[model samples]
Target: MHPSKVELRVLGTSVTLQEHIRKRAEQDLGIKLRFVVQDGGSVQRDGVMHPDRYELYDQWFHSIDCLWPTHALQPIELSRIRRWDEVNALPRTGRLSKAQPAGGAGCVPADRLFVQADGTLARKPSERISMLPLTHNADSFVYLPDSMPASLVEGEESWAWLLAPELAGRVALQADAAIGAIDAALAVEASGLMRFRDIGNLEIEEIDGLIGTLIEFKRRGHFAGFWSSFAEAAQLMIANKVVIQSIWSPATVELERAGLKFRLARPREGYRAWFGGIGISRLAHGRVLDAAYEYLNWWLEGWAGATMARQGFYISNPKQSRAQMSDAEWAYWYDGARASAELPGPTSKHLVPVGQVRDGGGYVARMSRIAVWDSVMDEHNYLVRRWTEFMRS
Candidate 1:
């Protein structure tokens, strides 16, 4: 019989928030916290959830309570990101401050706006965060590693580089495995660099499921390798199953904590980085939600950026966390450590930015190619169709 999982309804779209709560709840209550994740935003009558609404709902929590830990490693400051528009635009960036306030015609304050940059943001603060609508949220990016390092020297080569026949069944993708796998397949079809047979003998699973799957495969001596989230993938390495897992600088912190020995190797293609952030939930327990707000506030502090910098990831706000950091911390966060790979972001290199919060302490940089969860669902839907076709054929 399944134990009744606590459906503790709290608000926010930040996966870290959920993770924190789950970890805390389990430690305190001795019960597993099962999260029923909804998009972080207000209710929409659009007959569908609006992305902007979700972003706002997430930020609303930041206003009420600090949902994120002040000590968490947010590469950017919410306040600094909010006021980005007043300053010069980021290198190859776009803007997404388009929505009006709820039940009002005037534009939401600039502090609440979201922003997206192609590569990364400028190294310094430009203006006050009090002027923007919301902080910037970074989106996650994906990349493919090749054994033949020379095969990938260009960052813009496309997602096909991951699909060689030698890797067909052996390859594991992140969240977008179905489509990412297909993308790899299509890449192979187009490039004719490799030919793969059926995956009849391969083990496949979603990215989240990959962790357990990899563990299981390791126990059974069937492990190949994996890719996906930077944090968990690093943990996989700690477990010694991540022979060649996908990772980012944030994972480096976890690696250090776990005392794991690993290094980011030079890729045949250039390195790639994905941007992503948390959103507050409009539909949630106000108090618990307030705790989430507190967490976000904590993230905006200078110490948080220092933590992030020490961990190897870039914080959004370069200035707000200044007081919390020592000169040595700042040096380590920005210049002291080397990134795994200096690569372009995963978005189309032409998206806008949005999500300004906390007097410019942190922000979310929107994707150049904007995709809601629905788009991810759509890819899964197509994967189902392909699986159906494959079964029929």
Candidate 2:
């Protein structure tokens, strides 16, 4: 490794900072970049336990809640970020401000985003923050159009379909406890298997009830498999091993690349939303620290955001991203207009055909209607234990 190279540990689900953007950042910033990609769990664990090993960590916002308490991250000076004002304004004008369950119960938690005098995190405004906001999107399952019964093809899609008996033995689920539990809870409620008081932060009893139902389904061979990574999820679809399952945007793009047909659902029960960002490790100093900040700014630059938008992601600053996109690309992606020409995926491969419209319409319309946020629940430890049992069953 080059002595000046900055080590960045990012989520596998991150499509924005892939090779092209990294290469561009390297050329433009005059810094050597090294990427260590992993699933969310490994990223979180390594980031918290071994901060000295990586200069930068890119992951979901919920990770701030998990990592901040441990002092694993450094306070990012707002003045240093090129588009700090635009980043701050995102939650104020965008989906983060919207209440969850869409008028049912619970408010979006108050912003716990600030830097403290001790170089730790705090909730109030300050000269610094714990993380730099990056790419975010809502998630839902996908299913093969041909796999559904004729009667269900034109009918409304629901999260309940994950647990529908007709799809039993042909369904898959995500293997992550936090995300998988939320998806299962939604399915349980939507399928009338059970209901939770608050699905976002499930109580002990609620977790037990949901996992119990899932275990029973698992025992009956209802699931084709469980996937731990986006690539695994895409492969399952490609192999036709599962008819319906939780899906990430990039996975759907991969499925399309394989010439497989899948529809990302606009579920009637609403979508699971997630927010992600990048944070510098507390261990970074001097030149390495400078490189980390440079990488953060480069992510907010328009080109990477445009790449992410190609595969159904929204950046904190859309203005910058929009500038890098063509008019037709902007219309087909952000404006919900039907594609006038065949559109490309994140890797610039043809995916969306002419006249095809994006599912869930535009960003504002889709984000405003979130059912739950991907979260580490209150009984997270217990949820993980029970979830492990369910998976084993």
Candidate 3:
């Protein structure tokens, strides 16, 4: 190791840029890790516009389409990742099982993994990759059962409920268009408000139709709020300001700590999924570049993965994190078994009580049911233009 700390600036969203994670990285890697945390949209826009501002970029695979085209991020040499071969098949291939149906629609990680010689990303194997796959999860909306119009039987909760009359004026949506739009589309389709040829990549006509309907609802005061970060989303729930909303899993954990009973819907339509990882800034070099790789390798080395796993996210190298977790934690978080003891969450606090099972079952079972992924559509600019209109309206 270097005699002095090598500082690496990381530009990223709230998910991986968490304070605990930042401190841990600084401690483990013996480097100065600065996390410039922002909302997902801000991270993408900033990374694309000013990649040189940071040494490392951390976000979701969906961001590759935007960052890669601009050459904002450089390709990852997979061999540099110490546990490259240990990464699961979901990111290298589309499915966890050979018999599992294709990982449905949007920027599936496999489709963006390999970096081609033509300075492009592809599905085919190569020495270089677009991003080092890290954490991922199949996400569904959560609701306070008490606030829902009628009691929901677990596994019966539908995305349609987010738009139901009973929750009107008490519903929240994610403020960012790219991801929130997917949640909106899923709810709309589940409610029979409209249908689209491809929900992941909404065509302009579909965007208009979807936005038009949401705008009408907005006019009617259907939404309680639109949140930009996990803290904001958690506040909407913790204060009981909104009963149903799109949320990050960690926000749900916060709700639990606050003693707010909520049901993380195993939506009949299936969950909206996302995968997050790291990319070296295009301008990185020398010590900073080597430090970036160190941070990346550290992420796959189990501690960081274990940290994320505590919050309900699965790491690319599960085996690595599995070794770091307690037997009870592995069973509770991965095997779909009831907690053998009270479980600690992302933080050290033991927020998870014994006997509670994860909302969705095992890793394979939950991942297998993904309906779609957060995406960057072909008409992303147009979608942003229209999405801005929706936000303003």
Candidate 4:
């Protein structure tokens, strides 16, 4: 496994560490590609503490909060990426549409996109970046509307529903501290339980107050389970009878395959957004580095982006990916119009039946409504330590 072949090890979460992308990259780049896929927390930990183990890191832009501070990733030269400029304004300029304010909740991508001459990440664009922006999406909780309480109605959803006393013993949340806590904070605020000074970056007391409420809820048997992956999130609903829980897009599509009735809530408050991309390890150089750049550039040329779009993830460079998708697909997935015909996303077989519009709406509408972006708070270590009490209780 050494020397004879040009092998590139890419580390990331399940969101982008997909099998189809791996096979396609190997075929196109002519390099031995291996994706070390793990949960988001494990991926970030290994990437920061063990940079030499992988050549490229593929994960969300929020990762810069941890990886950049530790000097785990080298700057991705803007000149090296062929389609860098085509990336959408949201990640580059910090706003999806000019109508809204620049940047969204949490660690906004634009604020940390550039690597300044002084070697710090700031909003001012430079010749290099901490990560090559790739795929992204706006996420909200998913629930089975049919099984919900009469008081819980579709299109009138609220994050607070996750905390409703009626759903006790049947709710679930992701186990990750960063994401789980954000959703919990949203619920805590929405339920009139407590208000956060800053939901994205919780202070010490806020973390205590938030997690304390969650601990109480746990003791009351409000949460049915905690899921680590999309499949598990989907299964919790199917087998465990979890009627409502935080869920990813892939899991939503999987339920469509099973013919279940559900809705990815457009929470009245807004959405939790994230941007994912590739970054070279600081330890990478020579042939491995060259291959890493090749892989990064390949992600921008549209095929990989289009493939991910099928699963409801948006490519940073939307136009490039648009070319690879069919007209119906663009209409349904991007335009937010009713599907002219049957279509598929993030799966081999067709998933969307005729006349189904994408949940939330078009790209701009959904992205612009970000209530928070997935982020690591300033009190990250302490948050993790305290968050465990809620999970374990």
| Candidate 1, superposed: residue stretches over 4 Å from native | 1-15, 18-171, 176-232, 257-261, 265-272, 280-298, 336-380, 383-393
Estimate TM-scores for all models: 0.42, 0.92, 0.97, 0.97
Clashes of each: 88, 0, 0, 3
Error (Å) of candidate 3 at residue 354 is 0.9
Name the TM-score of candidate 3.
0.97
In model 3, pairs of residues that clash are none
Model 4 bad stretches (over 4 Å): 1-4
Off by over 4 Å in 3: 1-3, 151-155
In candidate 2, what are the lDDT values of residues 248-281, reduced to their tens digit? 8888888878887778899998888877788888
- Candidate 2 clashes between residue pairs 3 or more apart in a chain or in different chains: none
Compute the lDDT for candidate 1: 0.34
Q: Which stretches of candidate 2 lie over 4 Å from their true place?
A: 1-17, 92-110, 116-124
Q: Write the per-residue lDDT of candidate 4 for residues 1-393, one digit (tens) a residue.
A: 243379988898888888888888888888898889899899989999999899999988888899998999999888988877788788877787678765456988888899999999987989999998888888889888778888777337899999999899989999999889999999989999998877899999999999999999998889889998888898888884798998788788778877888888889889888888888999998878878888889998989988888888888888998889999999888888999989876656678999898889998888878889999899999999998887777
Whole-model lDDT for model 3 versus the true structure? Answer: 0.88
Candidates' C-alpha lDDT: 0.34, 0.78, 0.88, 0.87
By lDDT, rank the candidates, best first: 3, 4, 2, 1
Q: Write the per-residue lDDT of candidate 3 for residues 1-393, one digit (tens) a residue.
A: 681468888998888788999888888878898889888888999999998789888999999999998998888888788899988889888889789987788888899999999988888999999889999999888888776655444347788888987678999999888999999999999999898898899998999999999999999999999999888999998888898898888887888889988877788788899999899998998888888898999998899989998988899989999889999999998999999999998886687899988887899988998899889998888888888898899
Better of 1 and 3 by TM-score: 3
